[model samples]
Target: MEIAAAIQRRGLLFVLSSPSGAGKSTIAQMLLSTDDGIAMSVSATTRPMRPGETDGVDYHFVTDAGFDRMVAGGEFLEWAHVFGHRYGTLKREVMKVIEGGRDVLLDIDWQGTQQLKQVDPDIVRVFILPPSTEELERRLRHRGTDSEEVIARRMDRAASEISHWAEYDYVLINNDAEKCRELVHNILKAERLKATRRVFLHDFVRGLIG
Candidate 1:
């Protein structure tokens, strides 16, 4: 067998961050649909369930009191308040996925990414940027999901989000959605092949030499 196929590798946390309408969600959906080795890390939130969302699959929706209890118990790897809603990643669940050798994909904001890094510095961070602010506004309008006021708010917020692009390990311009997805996949593949992740490679090499 080839070295890539023979070596046992540890999994990693892959984080993707982008402002609204910058193609983050589209890329995330594409990756989840195409990649079997990676799975989305379901977040727990204190927000009410949306119309089409499922309980455990979309988010682990909880009451404010329940979320507070979890925070008090140190059950979260990272937690943040966004738009008056509390969102968090459960440490036990994410560690379980990583320990089982399956990469976890996180679609979170910059704040959550920073917190996750403090917890697990090995995470790979990628930020997507729109080609231009005007293009971003156009994409948001194309969606037709939000009101005029909401779109205006999102445009204002995008500026702040884009300022943190330098903090990510990799930054991609989302001018072409498909091309960007391909680049993201390539990054994941390369990260998976890194020598550090192949924990038993040295032993494998020794056995081969013997």
Candidate 2:
């Protein structure tokens, strides 16, 4: 009983992926709001700042030269260029949270997820899916942020994204917000108990023998 309470773990890197309108962001927000043990991963980017975005909270802004330096030094777990701007998962940033025995949540695409797994094979991956293509398109348009043309392009991109669903450890459809959130919460709970994550278990089990 004492061992159970004192069992320390090397925290998990929780990767959440989905097409643009599949509700992964909403689910991530719900988890962050309720769970104190998990924190979101703030990626570093070379993109210009937008209005009201904090330098460190939203992203760690860097210049092209600095980003190149980081890449050369082997500092990023994963890095990619999107439409000419560069973004990366900072090696130190993730370790700070994970070393403190807390989960790190990531909202990334399938390509980023693959790159992350290559660096840390212990990472837990989940993919969210929309109930239907029509529903996905409806949600995208209902937001009223993108034009019809953009929505059509996004729908096309969604098909390509969904093709990688099989790469994830868990795939769930976002048919209902409440249910979707609950399912993700449960998955995190299960992943936390995995044998590899519990480094203290070896000593705990050893004590049981004597």
Candidate 3:
């Protein structure tokens, strides 16, 4: 048998971060649906649970004080305050998934990605940017029913977020969403086959030689 066949691999944290109007979440959902080995990392939040949302499924809802305590105790791998609510990833839970040789997909912002990188430097970071600033604004306006002021604020935030594209490992210009999705699928497949991530490769090779 080939050594590659025998080597067991470790999973990676696949992160996708983008501006407010970019299709990060849509891409993430598409990835999850297509890839059975990867699972979405449910986040813990301090916000009130909305209708039809389940605990430990949609989000692990907690009190604001409890969230503060978790942050202070360093229980979260990454946490961020978004639109007046706190959201975080539980380090223990994510570690468990990674150890099981199944990838975890994270749809988060640049700040959260930075925090996650500090904890797990081996994570694969991918940033998706709209084809152009004008296109991003158009997408935002088309999707949101908010007032002009809110939309303008979102546009400003998108500009600020796009400035961090240089920080990511891979940057994809999302001119066409379907094409971008295929590109991301290819990236993940390549990352999964990386020799460095195959922790049992050495032993498997030795066995094959012996």
- Model 3 regions more than 4 Å off: 1-7, 48-53, 145-149
List residue ranges in candidate 2 displaced over 4 A: 1-7, 47-52, 63-66
Candidate achieving higher TM-score, 1 or 3: 1
* Highest TM-score scorer: 1
Q: Give the lowest summed-lDDT range of ten residues in model 2.
A: 1-10
Model 1: lDDT equals 0.90
Across 1-210, the per-residue lDDT of candidate 1 in tens digits comes to: 454543368888999999999999899989988888888888999988977899988899999999999999999989988667899998877877777668999989999999999988999999999999999999999988778988988998888999999999999999999999999999999998898987778877889999
| lDDT (10s digit) by residue, model 2, range 28-136 | 9999987888998888899888777899998999999999999999998898765357888888888888777688998888888999998889888999999999999
Superior by lDDT: candidate 1 or candidate 3: 1
Candidate 3, residues 129-209, lDDT tens digits: the string is 998888888988887555688788878788788899999999998888888889999999999878898777777779899
Which of the two, 2 or 3, has more TM-score? 2
Write down the lDDT of every candidate, Cα atoms only: 0.90, 0.87, 0.86
Would you list the rank order by lDDT, best first? Answer: 1, 2, 3
lDDT of 2: 0.87
TM-score, predicted candidate 3 vs. hidden true structure = 0.87
| Superposed model 1: Cα runs more than 4 Å off | 1-7
Worst 10 residues of 3 by lDDT: 1-10
